[model samples]
Target: MSMTEAQTTTRKQALGSPLDRADGRLKIQGLATYAIEKSLENMAYAVVVQSTIPHGRIRSMNIERARQSPGILAVYNHHSGLIIHPAKTFGQGGAAAQAFLPLQDDKVLWNGQHIALVVAETLEQATEAAALIETEYEQQAAIVHPDNPDARPETVDALTIEWGDAVPALAQAEVQIGGVYTTPREYNSPIEPHGCIAHWQDGSLTLWEPSQWVGGARQVVSEWMAIDREKVRVISPYVGGGFGCKGGIQPHSALACVAARELKRPVKLALTRPQTFTAFGGRPRTHQQLALGASRDGTLQSIVHDSWNETALNDVHKEPCNAVTPLMYASPNFLSHHKLIHLNTVNPSWMRAPGENPSAFALEVAMDELAWALKMDPLALRLKNYAEQDPQAKIPWSSRQLREAYQQGADAFGWSKRPLEPRSLREGRQLIGWGMASGTYPVRRTPGEAQIVLYADGRLEVQSSGVDIGTGTYTILAQTAADVLLVAPESITVLLGDTLLPRAPVAGGSQLANLLTGAVHKTALALRDMLITLAVSTEKSPLWQQSPAALALADGFLWLSDKPNLRVSFSELLRLSGNDKLIAHQDTFATTASEDDRNKADSTSSMMVPPTEGGVSAHSWSAIFVEVAVDEDFGTVRVKRMVGAFDSGRIYNPKLTESQWIGGMVMGIGQALLEEGAIDDRDGRITNANLADYLVAVNADIPELTTIDVGKPDYLATVLGGKAVGELGIVGVAAAISNAVWHATGKRIRDLPITQDKLL
Candidate 1:
C-alpha cells in the first residue's frame, strides 16, 4: 500500500477510531474536581508574598501587622525556618522546574521570589494580610537582558553537533542564503493556573494539584519534607491545561506543604493571574543565526545554525534551537551549536515544542529564502533536499512519508495555482499569497508500567499514574483495552494521575500515548491469555481441548471461531473455576536501550536514551500550507486559511489528534503575529503579566483550518506503531505564516510578531 494513504481501519481496529473523550460529560457538567477545588475540613488559605526587587537581600521582615490582621492564623518568612529542600531539577531527572529553593535565605534571586506566606481562614483575608506583611531590602544591580554589558554567555558543548566543515562548503556553493531570526520570550498561559492544596494527617501528606507528572511531584514533596516516599500521595485526576509549566514541581507546592505542616491544618494556595506569570518559567527569548548553501538545482549542500537563549543567573537552561536543522533536511556539511546567556530572569522551562518550535521558524524561513533566491518553487526545493535516511546517523527511518504529506497537502491547498512571483496576486486592497513548509519532530519513548483487572461480571479496570492534560487519555486507553479484550469501551474504566496507580512517566515530549497505550494493550493481552488457559484446562468448559488460536473472545464470551454454538461466558468459566476476578500487570519499554544508558539513568536520575536498531531513526513529519492576506494600506497581515498533512504512523484517536494539531497551529499563529512576554529591564519584572496585555490568538484571529492524516502503521517505532504528535503540529507553522507574508508583500521580516509597524 502507498504510505500516503491513511489507514482504512474501522472501529474494530480500536487504534485509529475517532472516539469521543470518555470524561467529556463529567468535565462539561463541572463535576470534575481540580487541584484547588479539593477542599478539606478546616482548610486554611495561604497567599505568597513576592519580592519587589530583582536582586536583593532581606534586611528585616515585620510580620506583626499580618499576625494582627483579621482571621490570620500565622505569618512566616525566611526566618520562619521552614523545613524544605530544593528538588532535583527536571533536567537532572527530578521534578522541580528550577533547582533553586526559595525562602531558604534572605537573598532574592529575581522579582516575584516568594518572600513570605500568610495563612488565614479565608482567601480574601489571606490576600489582605499578605499585602500587610512588610519587608526592607538591600538591592543590588541586576542584569536582566542578554544585551546588558554584564551578561556573559556560556557555550553548551553537549548540544553542539559538527559534521563536515560548513564554512568552506558554503563559500563554494552555487547559492547561499544567510540571515538572523529572533523570537520573543513566551509563556505557557494555560487556562488553569498552577495551584496546590496540601494536607498532612497521620504522619502522611496528601497533595491535590495540577501536575503532568504526579509520581515525580510525590517524590519531590517526599524528599523536601523529609518523609518516606510512600507517605506522600499526589492526586491530579483532571487538569484544566498544562502546556509545560505544570509538568514538574514548582516552589508554590513546597510552600503550601510547609504552611500546612506548620499550621497543623490543610493549606490551600492558588496562584493569582499575575502570580502565574511570575512564579513559573516560560520559553526564553531566542536569537538564532542561520545560513544555508544549495546547488543551482536547489539541492542543499551546507547548513550552519547557531542559537542563543536567555537563562537565570543561577540556573543554566539553554535552548537547542538548532536541533531540527540537522534532522529536517539532507546536507553533507552541517554545523549546529548552542549557547546560554546568563541573566536575572526566571529559568526557562519547556513550552509546547520548546526548542523545535522556534528552531523551525528560523530554519524553514531560511529555506524559503533560498528557494526564492534560486527562483524555484518552495515545495520543489524541499523535495530536492529531502532526506531519504538520517543524514547524520546514516540509517533508515522507522517510517517516513514526508514527501507524500507534501504532495497531498499541496493538492488540497491548490499550491499549483500560487504565482511564482511575490506580490503578484491581489484582490482589491488585499495582496494574497500562499506559502508552505515541512516540519519534523523526534520520536522518543521511555519506560512505563500499567495494571489491569477483569471481574467475572464483565467489568474492566485500567490504572496508571500518567495524566490526561487535556489530551484525551481516558478515551484512548479505553479504546486500546477494548481492542485487546473485544469489549465495549463503555465497560472499561481508566484511573490515572494518582500516586497509588502503577508507575508512569511525565506526560511531556508526546510520550504518554506511546507508552501507556502499549502498556494497556500488553496487559489486556496477558489477562486474555490467562483466561484462555483456565478455559482449556477445565473439563467442565465447552471444547476444553480446543486450540487457543482457533478460539475468539468477544462481548465477555469465549467460543470457537468455527463453532459459535460451543460458547462459554466469562462469568460461567470463573464460576466453575471458583474465581471472582482475573488480574495482570505489565511493564513496557518502547525502545531498546544499552546497559550504559540504563546505568546513566539509574545513577543520575536522568532520562534514558534508547539506542536505535542497528541505525534507525524515528520521527513524525508534517507539511504545512498557509494563505495570508496583507492589507495594502494598514500593513496588517491576516491569515486566510491553513491546511496541514501529517504522517504520524497510526493516529490513536483522530478527533483528539486533530484538536491537538489545530491548537498547535493557533499557538503558532500567535507566535508569528501576536505573542510576546514583555519585561521591565530595570527591575527584571514582567510588564505584561496578565492575559489582557499578553496577546494570544483568539477565535477571531484563527481562520479556517484543516488537517489530514496520512501514513501506515509503523511497528518499528513501537508496539502501537504510533509516533508523538503533540509537538509536531506546531513545528513549522510560524515559518509558513512568515513565508506567506513575504510572498504577499515582498518584504522579509526575520524578527517574530510581524506587526504592522514592521511592515509599514
Candidate 2:
C-alpha cells in the first residue's frame, strides 16, 4: 500500500453539493430553540449551592437565613422532601458520571460539589438565596498534582495487552527514545451551557434537555426517579454543541426534576459558565510515558506506553491513552497499560478525540525523535512504516489511502524544499520549519431507524431521533433522502431530536452521518418499492403488473425502465390507489464482526451495538502539515500556515465538511500552544476557572488554514461508503505543531500547550 506511481494518480470524486445547510435559516434568524429557551407556563427557577472546601466533611448547614430572602420558595438539602438515591462509584456504568449525586449524603469529596438546591419563584431570587445559604465543613488534606509519579488508585476497569518481551526487544534495537508527555485538564466549553427543564404531572415526567443521546437520557432519568422508563419523554430540538459532554443526564437534571416533584410545578435549571466547569464534565489531566525502540532504517521494533490519569475521589474515569500505540505502526513487540489516580477534583468525561488526541501527541512526537535519531525524513519514515492492515483487529482496512494522503499533503506542503536540520531554514530573524504527521480515527457504526412519509403534494418528510448540534445533520440527511428517492433536496423535510420518534444512535463519534444516511436511504428505497407496486396494480392508464426492479423513479414520477417517455407523477398514482399519502419505516443496523460468521448471534439486545464483523476494519485517515516560526529572542512560537489532507470516504456535503475540518484544526492549535487547566496546589482549587483566565484559540491567534479531501469511497464500511470525520481532523494536529516547533528551534517539547516557559 505504498504511494506507488499508479496509485499517486488516482483521484476520488465528491458526492454531493455545497449548498446552504438545511437548518441554516432557522439558526441564523435566532428562531432555533435551545434547551434553556424552553419555558413552561408555570415554570420556576432552581439554583445549586456548592461546597467551599476542596476535601471535607459537612458539619452543619444553616438555611434559615436563605429561606427569609426575597422571592424564596424552598431549599432542599440532605434532609429534604424528595430522596435521590446515590449509585455506586467508579464502576462500569458509574464511570461516565463525574459527580455521584446531589446531596445524596453529607460527605463532601471535592470542592464545588453540589450541596443543596434552592428553588424560587424567579431566577434572580434562586441565585441570591443560593449564595446566602452557608455550610460549615471540616477541611482535610487534598492532592491535586497531575504529575504525581507515585500516585495509584484502586483499579476499576483496566486493560492490558502484551505481545512479546518488550525489554529484550528494546535492548536489541539500534536506536531508542524515552520521554514523558503531559496534557492539561480542559473543558469542552460548548457555546450553550448545560441545562434542563423538568415538569412532572400525574407521575409522568416531561424533560426538555440539551443532550447528545435522548434515549440514554430517558433511561437515566427513569431509573434515577424510580419510575417507569415509558413514563418519561425527552425532547432536545437543538443542541449548541456537546463534544461528548451531553451524553447522559447529569445531577442538575435530577435536581430540577426533584424540585418540580416537591413543588408540584415545572422547574428550570441552567449551570452558569463558571459553574459549568465544575458541574459538567471535562477532559482529565493525563501523564503518559512512551518508550520507543526502532531500527536504524526507521522500522519500529517495540513500544511500551504507561499512563496515569486523574479522576474524582468518588468516581473513576480512564481514557484509553494507549489505544492507537500498539497498532498505529508495524510494531511486533508492544505493551500498553493505563491506571487511574483519584484526586479531589471534578470528574473528567469525554472531550473531543478523548483517547486518541493526547495519545497521538505522545506517539507522533516520539516518532519525530526516532526520525532524528535515524537521520531520516519524518514524512518518508512514516511512509516507510505504514501498516498495510489494522494490526489490532488483524484485518485489512476497509479503505485506506493514507499513502496517497502522505504524497498529496507532501506535494502541497513543498516537502522537497524542506531542510533536514533544525534552525537551518531561517528567514530573517524568524526560524522557519515544516513538519507533518498522519491522523487516524476508527469508523464506528450502530443501529439507526428512520421513517419516510411521501405526501400528496410531492413533499417528503424524514423522521429520526438524532440531534444536529450545528453539524449540518439536517442538510446531509435530506440530501441522502433526495439522492435515493430521486427528488429535489428542497422537497424533503427532516424531523429529529425527539425521543418519541424512531430510535437513532447518538450523534457523537462521527457515526451519525454514516449510520443515519444509510437508514434514510433504505427507507426511501422501501417507499419507492411500495409506490411501484401501487402504480402497476392500478387500472389507470399505465403499465400493469410491472416488477418493482423494472420501474425507475425520477423527478417525482414513476416510469418503466425501458421507456424514457412513459411516466406518471406519484400524485396521480396515489390518487388512483385511493390514498393521499404513503409511509414507510426502515431500521438498519451496522453489520458487526459476528455478522460475517453464519453461526454466530449478537450478544447484546441494545439498540447501539458495536461492529464485530469480520471485514476490513473501517477508519478515516489524514495527513497534517504545519509551518511554524520561532522567535528565539522572546521564546514565542507562531503557527504561520497549516494544511490538512483527509480521507473520510464519501463527501456528502463539501462546504460543511470543510468547515468542520477547519474548526478542528483551530482547536488543535489551541491545544498545542494555549489551553491548560491550572490547579492551585495549596488547597486543590482550579486557579483559572473562567474564560478570561484560561486561554483558548481566538480569531487573532489562528493562522491561515486549508483543508483538502483525499476523497476515497469506502464501500466496505457502509452503504454510503463514508467513515466518521468529526474527530480525525484534529488527531495528529498537536503532534505536527510540536514537530514543527522542534524543527524551528532545536528544543524537543514533550509536554502539551507548549508554553513559552518551556522554550526559555
Could you estimate the TM-score for every candidate? 0.95, 0.93
For candidate 2, what is the TM-score?
0.93
Top candidate when judged by TM-score against the true structure: 1
Give one digit per residue, the lDDT tens place, for model 1 in 660-689.
888888989999999888889899899899
lDDT scores of the candidates, listed in order? 0.86, 0.79
Off by over 4 Å in 2: 1-15, 86-99, 146-150, 153-158, 540-550, 560-566, 590-612
Task: Write one digit per residue (lDDT tens) for candidate 2, span 1-760.
Answer: 2222212221111127786787889888999988779868988999988877778788999999889998888898987756765532223432125447777788877777788999888999999989888899888767666545544555434456677878789889889998998888888888888999999999999899998877667766776788876788888989998887886567888888888888889999988877877786588888788999988888888888888778887676777788668656888888877878888887888788888888888889988888998889998888878899876667888888888888888888888788889988787888887888878887877767789998777778999887887788888888887776666677688898887887765677778888888888899889988888888888783857777677877667887878846767888787777888999998675355343221111111143334325477778888999999988788888899998999999888889898888878988998999988887776766778788987888998888898889967788877788876888888989999999999999899988888889998
lDDT of 2 at 618: 79
